[model samples]
Target: MSKKKIKADSTIGLTLKTMVISPIALAYLVYSIFQSQIQSFDSISTSLLLIDSGIVTALQLLLFTKSAKKVSLTMLGILQYISPTISLIGGVFLYHEVLTNAHFIAFVFIWCALAVYTISSITKWRQEQMKNEINMEA
Candidate 1:
């Protein structure tokens, strides 16, 4: 699709998402008001958090979806691992979170799954290349 078309589609999608979610948000806001769950809104930190979680997060997701469309499926699959992996590393090193035995086992399993996927993908690609070569020779 053309850039203009893609932009238009993204805008429409974002609008539709907001339209669908707005009512639920309004309901929650009302509930919070009646329940006195909302504290002072006068704080700059609170305002910044609201903006970051609502607007910034939506824009980031929109951008991510748009960018993901431009990459190949295999590359996208591998790229999906990056964020969680980074978070896990950060929790272990930066936060000094202890990696328990279960966490270590799960992490190993996930890496093993990724390794199997990568190897299979490479093997498939090589097979396809050989098939094409044989067809050319024939």
Candidate 2:
């Protein structure tokens, strides 16, 4: 399908999902308000922070879905770590968070797994390309 069609389809699906979920979400918000569970914002800054977070989350999802179509599934899976890895680095350096032995071991194992996956994907892709070339030559 064309990119335009795919985008239109995604928008339609998003709209349908929002239509179904929005009412339920609104009901929950109403119930929370009735139960006095909804707290008033202490400052405009806090409300702005909440709105900013929502906007960032929505943009992340939108961009992720848009780029997902242009890459292989394996690449997409590998790319999923970019955000968390940045967060981990930020926590360790900027936030002065400590990584325990367990965290180190987990990171080592994850890197090993990713390395294996990437190597195998590259080998498979090369084999497929060679096969196609051979077929074209024949």
Point out where model 2 deviates above 4 Å: 1-8, 16-40
Model 1 ranges with Cα > 4 A deviation: 1-8
For candidate 1, write residues 1-138 as lDDT tens digits: 433345455666777878999999999988987898987466989978887788888888788767766877778878888899999999999999999999999989998999999999999999999999999999
Error of 2 at 93 (Å): 1.1
Clashes per prediction? 0, 0
lDDT (Cα) of model 1: 0.83
RMSD of 2: 4.0
Top candidate (TM-score): 1
All candidates: CA RMSD (Å): 4.1, 4.0
